[model samples]
Each structure stands twice: as C-alpha cells, then as structure tokens.
Target: MRATTTPALFTRPRNVAASVAAAALALTLVPGSASAQQADTEPVDVRLKVADAAPVEVATTPQAWPGELLEAYGVSVDGNDLVDVVRDGDEVSGERKRLRQGDVVRLTDVVKERKTKRERVRRGTVEVFTTELKPGVRKVVREGRPGTRVVVARKTFHNGEPVKYRVIKRKLVKDPRPRRVLVGREAYAVAGANGLNWGALANCESGGNPDAVNPAGYYGLYQFDLGTWRSVGGSGLPTSASAGEQTYRAKLLYKQRGRSPWPTCGRLL
Candidate 1:
C-alpha cells in the first residue's frame, strides 16, 4: 500500500532532495501528482567552482567574487577573453590573449630572426708595407695565403614562408697572410773623407775643365782612359759626362786602386 503522507523537501536544494528518498522526492513532494505538477521550483540558486586559480585574497577574505579591470568597462566574466587564464603563447581563434611570465609566445604570423654561425670564409689578401722598393713600384717577394672569417646572416620569413636572407655581422677568423715586397731607396753616403784632396787632383789633371780631353785621347778632368772609365761605371767617354759625375767616378776610382791611376798627376794631389 502506498503511504498517503506528504513529504516536505521544499527547504533543501533539488540535488540534495533527490538523494533523500526515492519514495518521496520529485519536482514536488505533495500529496497528489496533480498538486506536485502545479507547484514547481523556479529560479533556484546553485554554486559551482571554476577551473584556474583566482586571487588568494578573494578566496580567503570576505571580498567581492572574481572581478577584473574589465568590470569598469562594463564587460561580463562569463567565458570572457580578458578574465580567462592566459599563457605566453596561448591564443584563441588567431587572436592573442594576455600573457603570463612563464608563457612562451610563439609567433606563427611572421618569423624574422637572425641566426649567427661560424663558416669558412674565403681567403683575403694582406698588404705589407716595404721600404726596399721605390714608392710607386710594387713587387711581391713572398706569396700570400687566404684567410678565414666569421659571417652572420639573418633569415626573414612571413606566414611560415621564407622571404630573404642578409648578412648581419662579419668577423675575421684567421688573419690574412702578408706578402713581402722589395723597395729601392737612395744610397747612404760615406761619412768622412780619407785625407785625399779631390779639388787639387782635378786642378792638376785638366785645369778644372771637367770636359777636357788630352791629345793622347784620354777623357775628362781626371784624364780617364776607356779601359779605366768603364771600370768605374762611367759609360761612353768620361768627358761626355757632367763635371759632378766625372768627379764622382774619379773619387770611386781613387777609393778602389788609389792614386796609381793618376800617376804623375796623382803626386800633385
């Protein structure tokens, strides 16, 4: 026999009342099914915990429930992008959300970055300055070797597509080998005279006439024969050269073989 008693479950929540007893709990627990249908629970209040941590201050204190800066802008927190938990790279529908410190922002839109690497650079030429050769004359006495260097380049991409490449940094890995060059310069003069009177010798030889020639066919102020003049780096006849050149040759000749070449005139000097 079914009991004819009315069970009161109006004071409790629907879920709590459901577990009370299968014999009495329903949309309403009135005496008749007709009375239960007319009397129904409407606009009931329920509480649920959402995922993601909120401010510890809000949970511990009697403060207003989860609120954000967006509340001043009149926005609701129900699945709103602003109030939801956001990571560094977490995005929704191709739109970016707020990022936390630990979030890694993955930029899939346009990736433009510079990656530097060490590579074998082509050999380079080194310039070695030399005083052994003349100013404008260049001569490489030693061969040069190529050197290595470091080059940095940047790669640009757009929408996961490659666009361009450019060099960003350049550094020398190995220094270039230098070439040795020989150059020419003016010869240094001998410091002091060796007690020989060049003026006296010239005066005695041809009366100081650098262009003088003897009747015997000997040439110059110092009376140089072909054989002797050629030995002292004098081309052609000594008389054909300038006074300074003739004197210089005579001085050189004197240094080598002494006054013996002059003979009679040598005694006068």
Candidate 2:
C-alpha cells in the first residue's frame, strides 16, 4: 500500500453540544432581536377620564408619556387645563411620569370669566314732626329715589361648571335720596271733633295745604268761610291765622254744626 495522508476535512468537533449552546446564547443577547424589542415596549392598559366624561380604556406602551398618550387618543388639552396621573391609589405628576399598567389619567378643564352687573340701592325714610296740621296727619314732602351701582366679578369654571366667584370692583353710579315725610302734632279740645279724621277732611277740602284759599270765600286747611270762621271765635282770616289756630277753630265749628259747615268735605270727618 502506498503511504497516503487523509485530509482533516471530515474531522468531527470535540465539543459539538457546547458550540450549539454558545450559539443559542449569542442569539438571545442581540439588541435588535424580536424578543428584546418586545420586552422593551410591552403593552400596558390605562384609563383616561376627561372633564366629567366617563373613563375609557387605552392600550399604550410602558414608556409612553401622558401628553403623547392623550394626543394618540384624540384628546385635546388647552393651556389652562390640568392633567393628573394616579398609580396604585396615589397621585403622581403627569408631566414627569410615564404610562403604566392600571394607571388613571385625569383631565380637568379650567375657564375664567369677568362679569359686570347693575344693582339697585334702596332709599331710606325720614320723618319730621310739625304743628302746622292736626295730630296723626301725614304729608309727603319728597319722594324717595333709589340709587344704582355697578359690580364687577370674576367667575371660575371647572369642567364647564361654576366653581368660585369673587368680586373685583364696585362703583357707585348714583346716591340714594331719602323720602321726607311731615307728621302733625297739633292738639284740640273739641268733644266730638277732636277724635274725627281731620286729616282726611283737610285733604278733601284744601289738599292738606294750610294756606289754601278758594275763590268761593273758603280758606285755611279746612276751607272755612269768613262767616263760619267768626262763628267759631276766629278773629283774623282763616288763611292768615296759624295752622294750629285754624285747626282749633275748625274743631269748634265741627262740634257746633256736626260737620254740616262743609257739605262736600264733611263726609271725610
């Protein structure tokens, strides 16, 4: 036989099992492999609540940010709106946090508005006593006038509902005018006339004017004529005498004639 050397081409590996194991480990350590990528971006389930609306479930990656998730979910947020995140029953900063499984995202809409309104100020009453008319008589000297004011306020709304209101400014537009009333305190000693409604009689005769004078010779608060005034012991003209004296004389006349001196106004007494 000729001395021929066989080639090592058909030689078998000494550690074939170890070589297969090393190859499998190298495949698992690859950075761009499907298993590695899937592990890095695992899907997470989260809940999103926006401005009084019902909560909705969303599926996102664990590394996703709050704003990015909202944008992907078609949720728009304004500049004044607020966003909060809750995880494991505790609240966290939405801006600095990433989405996690079982996480809750809350969105609140905030709005501020300025309003103005006109308000009315009620007027007061002032009473003045005078002896120019009989007791218990009243006269309106000046009518009351209400004032006006403008109020400015700031209203805050959360989730389209009013939350707080604060007054910013107040301006007085007009001052209120008080009502002036004149009351009577005159006294009389007539038996049946002192207790009569002399005020109504005066108002019916002379419109409650103490210096009233009629063209038919009637004068004073009671509109007494010259003859009737003298019969009641009145010396000067009824219009020239004081209001107290005129009332006294009218009472005396009423006691004598029993309201027959003035036919038209006697019904009032």
Candidate 3:
C-alpha cells in the first residue's frame, strides 16, 4: 500500500444549512430588496399638508394712570382738580396747576393797600356870658337923700332905684376858645427834621393856632396830648408859652424814631 496524506475538514451542520438557505434567499430576493431599498433611500419632494389656522386674537386695552398730576408752582388752587383751577380760574394758559397730597386748594392775590391816616384835630372852645352889676354907677353916688337938703350927686340919679347895670368883665378866662389844632406839636417839630411838610400839618393840627387847646387838655400849636406832651419833654407850658418849643422838640423826636411826624402833627411837621 502506498502512503497517502489526507486533509481533515470540519463543518457545523446547522450553520451549513442556514448558509445554504441564506444563499438561496439572497439569490431569489436580492433584486427586489435592492429596488425597495433604492426607493426608500432616494430623496423625495415632500410637501406638508397643513391647514390654515385661524389668526389668534390678542385682547389689547389702553393703560391709564391713577390720578391727575398738577404742574403749576406757587399757585393756590380752589377746585378738586388743580389743572382746572390754574387754567380757568387763574386764566393762565400753559400753566396748569399741579396738585399733590395734603395740598390746600385756595388761590388769592396778596395786595397791600396804602395806609390812610386821619389828621389829628386839636379841639378848643370859646365861651361868653353876661351878668348884672349893682351898687356902682358912673363915678358918682347919692349920699344923704333929697329930703335932708340933699347933697347934690353928680350926673343926676334917684336914690334907692333899681339899676339894670352890672360890671361886665371877665374874671377868669380859661382856654376860652375852641381852636382846631394838632395833637402833637413836639412830635411835629421833631418830624421837621425828616422833611415833614408843615403846611399841611398846621392846616390839620391847630389851623396854626398857637393858643389852641383840645377838650382832652392837649395844648399848643401842635396840640400835644397831655400824656404825649409829658412824654416828649413837655414842661406843662401853657399852649401860648411853648408852641415853638414843643414844635422843636417834636422835630427832634421825628429824627430819632423815623416815624411819620406829620400824621401826629396833623401834617404840621
């Protein structure tokens, strides 16, 4: 016998049958499968069939601020709304009033009027009266009587006759005349230094009566009230004695106090 070498071969029976079935199926289905794959892989012109949706509606409203704002400055308002007051009441255009919390709503104009001063009137009065006098006649009197051989009395008159004559003279003449006068002569005099106009002051004070005295005991051309006179260095001089002096003193005071002396002096200063 010749020496023979043989190669050993091993095969799984289940795998072999599967492989044969796979080969048969591949041979039979490969063309159809390839065409199906090609159809799936190829890009197609796709179109989405989406229906038109109704337009979504959004609710919208205007926003408003809570309260009105006032823009006016330094003006008082009298109405509920500041703008109305400034526009209508004040008649100011482009200047509407701005209102704020705790604000007082009243408007007014501050006006100062010139002061009116009444002239001081120096008061004075005059009095006159008549009285009957007896027991005296024209430098002669009857002594004894006509029955006792009668001493001749000069200028002939009967004895024991009632005479309608009386001594007519003033016993006491007080400030016997009412004169229009100023109340503050000294004050006026002092005012003279301050360019006080005496022309008008005298017209109002005493009408230029140096002897004028008021019912209130004010005396002199300036008609110084008793209290005022005493205060202004008045020496209680009779109105006649101290008119000039009082005026001088008053002018000095005017210079000191810067007050309108003419008012006190009835414009005399």
Candidate 4:
C-alpha cells in the first residue's frame, strides 16, 4: 500500500519556475521499491490524491529520494517522474527544455549567482646585497640596499562568470638590496716608480710649449724651476735651453723618481 504525505515543498528547475503544468497522462503515485525502502527506514512511500478522483497506482520508486516534497506543487509523482513533463515549454532556437529521467522540474526560494573577484595586499620583506672584493682593492662599503615597489592585480569571479572587478589595493612583496656598484680606487705601485711617458707628461705640464713660462718663475716646456734646471746640468733659464736639452733633463728626473716629481699630471704618461 502507498503512503500519503502532505504539505510538501516544491522545487523549481534551475532555469524555469512557472513552466510546470498538468500532464496529458495521469500521474499515479506508486509505492517505493524494496531497495529504496532499504535505503530509507521509511521505504520509498509515494501516494497521490487527485481532486474528485481516486488515488492511482504506478510503478517503480523514487531513487533514494523523498517524493512527498512534490505534493505542494500539485505534481503527482509516479516514481521519479510526473505525467506530461515534456520538453516543449520554454523556447530557445525554436526548442523547449527537454525532460530526462533525472531532471529537476521546479524550484522555490532559490538565489541566482554571479561571480566577481577582489584584490588585496600583503607586506614584503627587505633583502641584503653584497659586492665582492678583488686584488689591489682596499675596503668594501655597505650603504644599505633598500627595496623597490611592485604593482599587482587580482580578479574575482561569480557563477563561473566575471561580473565586477577593480584594482582593489596595492601590495608589497619583495625587499631589494640597496644600490651597489663595484668600483676600484686604490693604486699600490710606488708613485712614479714606473718610467713616465714624457711626451704625455709635457702636454699636461705646459701644452708642450718649449718657451712656456709660468708667472711664478717656473720656466720651460717641463715647467722647470731655476734651481731644479741647474741641478739637472742645465745652465741659465730652461726656456732659453734647446728642446733637446730640456727633454734630456726631463728624462733624468723621470729615471730618478720614476714620476713622483709630476704626480697628478704624470698619470697621462
């Protein structure tokens, strides 16, 4: 014998709500199968009461489901289906939503869904940078390697579709080391111990003017002082000396001190 339940809950299909209607065939509520009954202690109890008509008998049972929930919708459940539940209701491309064995026909109190994404920021960490030292190198200095900033974006979704989006916020993710450049600044060789290239030395001293004389009594292409010129075996003013004599004396000075005598300017030589 089929059992009857009242005050059932109705469910609308995912897409349509008002499309349900009376069927051409009589929908008879049948008793559940033994398996359905075993799955539920209550058994698959389903019974239908039609207005001005006697209750009818159908076959099979609802698969591990509650059939009483269909009552309030005026749907007569014969097993898992209702009579006249066909595929000719809502039109799309000249076709209606087709009904299959396990289709949900109706729904109530359902909420529509839309997808969206939001962005957020998180704090970043600072890092250290080191420069290697090489031979003839003096000391390594550290100035602190402050990091830089980066921009990022995030997207959210609703109902498997994008609805709303924005550049919600900024985030810091990396701390870079301070700016560092490897440099060389020290000279280990004895000043001027290496022979000087005098041609370059003359250009720096006086633009190679053999008659060049400074206001301070320094005279000649080599900018020789009076005493220094005589010490180098040159008599009289160096400007009065021949270019050959002046060059000879300059060579002597280079041999003695390498180039310490012309420190800053000798580097070109």
True-structure RMSD, every candidate? 25.4, 24.0, 49.1, 20.6
lDDT of 1 by residue, 1-269 (tens): 01111343211222222322332223243333332433432321111112121111101111112231112111123321223332433443222333222322121223467788766644444454344666547676777666777888988754346777999889987876755555543232111333567778889988988888898978888989999999978998898898877877887787788789988889865
Off by over 4 Å in 2: 1-39, 63-65, 88-90, 93-98, 128-138, 183-269
Candidate 4 per-residue lDDT, tens place, 1-269, comes to 11123312122232112212221121232233233344333323333222212333222234423233343233444332222222234322212323233333331121223333333332233332223445345443444444444444444332234444555445454554444344442222223423456677788898999999999987877898998888767898999988767877777667666567777786776
Model 1, position 83: C-alpha lDDT score: 31
Every candidate's lDDT = 0.50, 0.72, 0.34, 0.46
Per-residue lDDT of 9 in model 4: 19
TM-scores of the models, in the order given: 0.30, 0.46, 0.25, 0.27
Using TM-score as the measure, the top candidate is 2
> Which 10 successive residues of model 4 have the least lDDT summed?
15-24
Tens digit per residue, CA lDDT, model 3, 157-237: 111223233332222222222432223232222323746664455557778777887887767666666676666666665
Better of 3 and 4 by TM-score: 4
For model 1, the local distance difference test gives: 0.50
What does candidate 2's lDDT look like per residue over 1-269, in tens digits? 01012211111223223322343344234444332455556667778666666566656657567765554433455677777888898888734478789998777767889999999988889988677878789999999899999999999887788999999999999999999999887554555667788889989988989999899888989988899899988888888888878888988887787878888889987
TM-score ranking, best first = 2, 1, 4, 3
